[model samples]
Target: MTTDTQTQPSSDPRYPVGRFHKPQTIDAVAIETGLKTLEELPRKLRNAVADLNDAQLATPYREGGWTVRQTVHHVADSHMNAYIRMKLALTEDAPVIRTYEEALWAELSDGKNAPLEWSLQLLEALHSRWVMMLRSLDDKQWQRTFVHPEHGPVSLQTGLLMYDWHSRHHLAHITSLRQAKGW
Candidate 1:
């Protein structure tokens, strides 16, 4: 018989799907406030994740899906890419951020087999550097723009807001999955 795990989707998709479908739109003031919230996100996420054990971290909500380790690693990878994009935007005149096949990255061996500790460490370091980058940006730097081939024009402000949204969204997903499984 097919179990619940066989029928369900990964928790990460529950909220972040909206971000993928609806591109971010925000004003500078909103971006500033959102960036503040984003800066606090790593500590909040680490706190939330602290209660979950390695099994919980490794459990896939569904079959043929990523476990929590993969999800955390994906966050690190995604944030690293965003940090690089922000740097490019500040340094270049309307640079286009390079896109990669996210699905392919999600399927790599590390994604499939890495220990939860590695993903957690990556998340910690990635968020540390990303927050530093955000904190260092002046108003002009925050306003820097880049063209994403798929998402059209994106500003560092909007990207920061999106990253803020990203952290909470994934945290919610993780919480929901844990509740569903009573873990």
Candidate 2:
């Protein structure tokens, strides 16, 4: 008879916030909205895990998913790569950005065991700088493209949207886990 997030599992735990939608048309308003998501992630994610002790941090958001600790670290990892990719796209023409094994990265010593403070602090600083640069991009600059070896060419507008969705996506994982476990 009880219907709460804890009692009712989301349709797909992997995508509590739903998947990212590639926009048919991305304008400045859309870019600004995405920037807000980017701007807010550090504070939002930090608060999501603020009170969780190490034991809770080690709990996975879902079956076969990254633990909360790894999730936080992974955000730092992924966002760092994104920041660099954006920089490269702006400086170089259709730069071929390198890819990484995100799953494997999540299993590394830093990702798996390092204090969340380190990554949280890094995100605060990284997002600050990233937002500053993103805000300065002109309409012509937003059209800049970067090529992921696998995903093909990605415009800055699209990157902004994806990372914005990504910001919400991963944050949902942690929050949804907390709700489910009644933590």
Candidate 3:
């Protein structure tokens, strides 16, 4: 029986690299690896969106997801918050970190229509400073903790892992789209 039925892509397009899962323990090796990933993110991300035109950038990686443009800007916005959170954790005793509505942030005009270069450049500079800060942290500093209203009591090590995974996760979203579309 040859009944025609359209088959959609098997995988979840929104999470091409799967979701982030915090590790049970954060060791020196894990910290080293996470730092390496953080260092490489700016370059990896830049390469992902390179040569993409406005129309291509406007195209969503998934059917009902933010456009590539929004994704890039969101990375900048999110990473900025993370950098500040790191600083706060270093200074305070488990400070409560603020959370914003990322979906709403993506709807802002700058997120939707601003040039990707702005975010890319911001990411590069921010990451450079962030990497420097990460490298300068002592063992005690890495043990610093922050409280998220939702997650609660996030250590610096976990924060590092989360952002490292976050970098790869979002990069995969764009790269997978490029491969799927032959871009």
Candidate 4:
């Protein structure tokens, strides 16, 4: 049986860094690497959109997928939720986290037209606080679990790895689009 951590057979544009291969196991080394990815995400993301203008940002990375702009804002929105979830998981007993309609959220005004700098700056601050919180977690804290209404229980260790993969995934979307369009 294919598990969540297994990489899929094809390289779809929709999943640029490939689907997140949820590791079959979790350890300090794995968490450390995830932490590195989380720490570097802000800088890498800033560089991804550094030279794009409004017209370019509005272009879709794929035929029917979100525009580069929406992706940026979505990252901000999604990560904000994740940060809150982490907080909840730490203080509460297996708290069930809220789910969002990301597609609908992408269609909202700010998500579609907000300045890239806004999301970029938000990511910088978000990741800063996020990384700080993550770095302080002890062994017991790392095993904290949160229930996703849809996906069921998720441990902080797995969440860290998934979000780390998420950062690289979206970065590839922006960078691949730039390469394809010769931007």
Candidate 5:
């Protein structure tokens, strides 16, 4: 089965890559592909927004949705949480991970108005560290689990794939808007 990045088109703009569905079993190739996706996300995202002006950046990707600026910042925010959660899972036994209201976080000042450069830089640095940690893990470590307050126990493998989908999902938001608006 394909990951969200490979899914067929959907009508929902909010889920351009399609929604993430945890794979029944994550094999070595799936893990490798996920790692590659994680590594490419910052570059892909940067290219997606590089040509936009302040007005374009401030334009919402969809009606009643986050502006392109907010989407860029949100990816950094969300991925940072994923990285920390992975660390917590690796270091503790079934650590109960904290969950935040992402919509609320997106509405915060930094998410709404921060320069895209700040978040872009954060994604580069964060993904570099995150990929380093992911590469260092052995089979046993990959199987480590973390409990989320909302989703119960989740394996490191699942988390990796989820974030891979997440990276594409938001990037698609920007690209699709660019296509629709001819930006």
Candidate 6:
């Protein structure tokens, strides 16, 4: 099981990491939207992420960039945080969540040197846990709120969407890198 402590800084401005976005409310999570996102995720991302060899996973996007391993680790970390946030919101009052420096976290040796196998295993387990958690949400749990230090109050439902997007986002990054290398 991965901890929620890891995160990566986004050099890509469009996907600023660790930022909170308000969710449209539990009533708005439209069953179709969640189901559609859920159905597409494994089908779309499995081959992109799973087919890589160890060397491919270790390949950094650029000279100073994070490898695929770090990206997946970031995913596990971020989702783990999301799950915890949901739990907290359901059990306690709107809690002010903790914040960390993503850049600093990703720069750690573990982030740079972690094996691809470690990250892949983390992803498999993390996604399993996340899906189970999301599926178990009641209407109230889905609407639970968390007070983010930077982004203010955001709903648990939005956090789920963020993770869904996160899965696709990093899958795209890895697939793009593979294409660039003509692998």
Which candidate comes out best when scored by TM-score? 5
Better-scoring candidate (TM-score), 1 or 4:
4
User: Could you tell me every candidate's TM-score relative to the true structure?
Assistant: 0.77, 0.94, 0.92, 0.94, 0.96, 0.73
Scanning candidate 3 in windows of ten residues, the lowest lDDT window is 1-10
lDDT of 2 by residue, 117-167 (tens): 999999999999999999999999999999989989999988988898788
Candidate 4 Cα outliers beyond 4 Å, as residue runs: 1-10
| Superposition error at 139 for model 4 (Å) | 0.7
CA error at residue 118 for candidate 6, angstroms: 2.0
Q: Evaluate all candidate structures by whole-model CA lDDT and list the values in order.
A: 0.68, 0.90, 0.86, 0.88, 0.90, 0.65
Better of 4 and 6 by lDDT: 4
> Candidate 6, which ten residues in sequence have the lowest lDDT sum?
1-10
lDDT of 2: 0.90
Clashing pairs in 1: none
Clashing pairs in 6: none
Pitting candidate 1 against candidate 2, the one with the higher lDDT is 2
Which lDDT value does model 1 have at 101?
78
Compared with the true structure, what per-residue lDDT tens digits does model 3 show for residues 17-47?
6666666667777788778888999899999
Q: For model 1, state the Cα shift of residue 164 in Å.
A: 0.9
Q: For all candidates, what are the clash counts?
A: 0, 0, 0, 2, 0, 0
lDDT of 4: 0.88
Report the C-alpha lDDT of model 1 over 1-60, residue by residue, as the tens digit.
Answer: 112111223334554324422233445566565566566666665665677777787786
Per lDDT, the best of the predicted structures is 5
Clashing pairs in 5: none
For lDDT, candidate 1 versus 4, the one ahead is 4
